[model samples]
Target: MNAEPVRPPAEAPTTELERADDGAAEPDATEQETAAPEPAQQELAAREQAAREQAAEPSERETAEPVPPEPSKTAEASPAESVPTQNLPRDPARASDVLVHRALPLIRSGELGLAEATLDRAWELDPRNPQAMAGYAALYVAAKDGDRALKWAKKAVRRRSRRPQYHVLYGDALQLQGDVTGARKAWTRALSLDPGNREAKARLADTSAQAAK
Candidate 1:
């Protein structure tokens, strides 16, 4: 019994008690390193999810269907269009006659400017018309521009030699320019064209009286 002296069992290893009063246990270096990467992994996963969502979304131009262009309002003709087919083969002679008729009232009312403007428009409508040229001659006669009157009157006579009015207007211009003989000849021709022409008779009488004077 003395040789086998019993030795007390080795005291059980005692674990150190963690106190609540002290701070929580600090992680080891290896644990801290591993934990630091967890936040980065989560952030990387979040970024990847956001990228996936962005890639799935359609762009504005791609999402919207192509819209057709609206038809042009100006290009399309209206159903009730007013086409001037009546004047398609424009009769300058007829147009000038109508204009002269319209302008006569204005001339008689002493609206010389307006009459002249209307006659000018008539000339533009029918430049070669005898009536338009005669109108211009009459306007110049009224304005006391004897030279211009004679010029236009001669043109009218040349264009329409058979017109009694054209001969009469030529006689008037000649009278204004003091060409008594020429006026008498023109008025005589007018009377020959129309025997009952009062204006030609009066003009002839006046020319005869002037020659006697």
Candidate 2:
């Protein structure tokens, strides 16, 4: 009987440097793979990083916030602003006082013609009164008579120099007559006399705005 021949396994390929360098053997591909992750593993990591960034883009956009709008500015109001008016005298206790109470309301209500006639009756009763003089000035102001208002307002303040309300009336008359400087002085005087006078404070506030212009 005849027998068959057996062959050994083939050797791996190598170059001069791969075979030996300074008496040390170069590593085979399997040994290199065990020593460190290289080209193939690095390429796979780069592809996964790119995929993760792409997948996160839509969620990042959905979580974004919009800016809100700002509020608009408005004009500031005056500290002592109020209706143009005078405090009515205490309930009448005299003949002339009865007319003052009646006529002051008429003047406030804009009935200048009737108020003037009623004021004439009060004038005949007590012509020297500062209250009557201021009332007359206010009535003339309502009547749109700047000259008359100024005239009577001046007389009223002169008649009662210590009265803050009379000074306030004088300021109103000065403003109506286009004497802004005089009006400021009158209001300033009123404040010096009675710092808590609200109408004087209101008039001065308006005067300050006018001066700025």
Candidate 3:
């Protein structure tokens, strides 16, 4: 029968000071002063000098960097981003239509000046748009500016020649302006464009009778 040999683990390495600390006390101060060489003292002085240089470097750097000024409350509150503009849809919803709808709220609130300004901007954005001219024409009529109403109505008709409503508006403007013959002609044109146009038919008959009389 054979038995395997058991080996203890190897011991960790230890410094000379640590080995001495196990049981032996350090040398007395008088003994150290007599035994310690000048070279050791020079090394100790150099290590202290290096530590002092490291500590002084950080303080010198802190002094070199100037303190930043405190920020004003107004400066912090100033907006860094711009306000977004709300734009109209580009599809079948025309700019003129959007302007008209937007102006309605102002009109309802009796903000006629703002309503007119909105309509004016709409017309400027789309000068050839029938709806824009129609809105302006209606506004002029409501404001009792017959001359501007007639001008805008005629422009609306000229821009959308095939629209019966445009012709009807022109006829109404002419009627209001005392041009009975011209009104009858405009209404007749509107009726010819749309045979079932009730407004044009009624207006045409009324104007014709008035002219005959």
Please tell me which predicted candidate would have the highest TM-score against the true structure: 1
How good is model 2 by TM-score? 0.54
lDDT tens digits, residue span 35-126, model 3: 85689788999999999988877576577978799987666422212111148766433766787767656656766676688777666666
Candidate 3 Cα errors over 4 Å, as ranges: 1-87, 90-93, 101-114, 208-213
How well is each residue in 1-213 modelled by candidate 1, as lDDT tens digits?
Answer: 458878999976555553443457767999887766677798998999999999899989998999999988787643223212233336766766787776666666766676777777677777887787888888888888899999999999999999888899999999899887888899999999999999999988876787789
Alpha-carbon TM-score of each model against the true structure: 0.55, 0.54, 0.49
Best by lDDT: 1
**Cα error, candidate 3, residue 194 (Å):** 0.9
Clashing pairs in 1: none
Better of 1 and 2 by TM-score: 1
Tens-digit lDDT track for model 2 on 1-213? 667666677786677886567469667989877787789998999999999998977875577796676664535432223212244344333555666667788888887766777677667667776677888988887777889999999899899899998888888888888888898899999999999999989988887887789
Give residue 179's error in model 1 in angstroms.
Answer: 0.6
lDDT (0 to 1) per candidate: 0.80, 0.78, 0.76
Candidate 3 achieves a global lDDT of 0.76
How many residue pairs clash in each candidate at the backbone level?
0, 0, 0
Q: Candidate 2 at 127: error in angstroms? A: 1.8
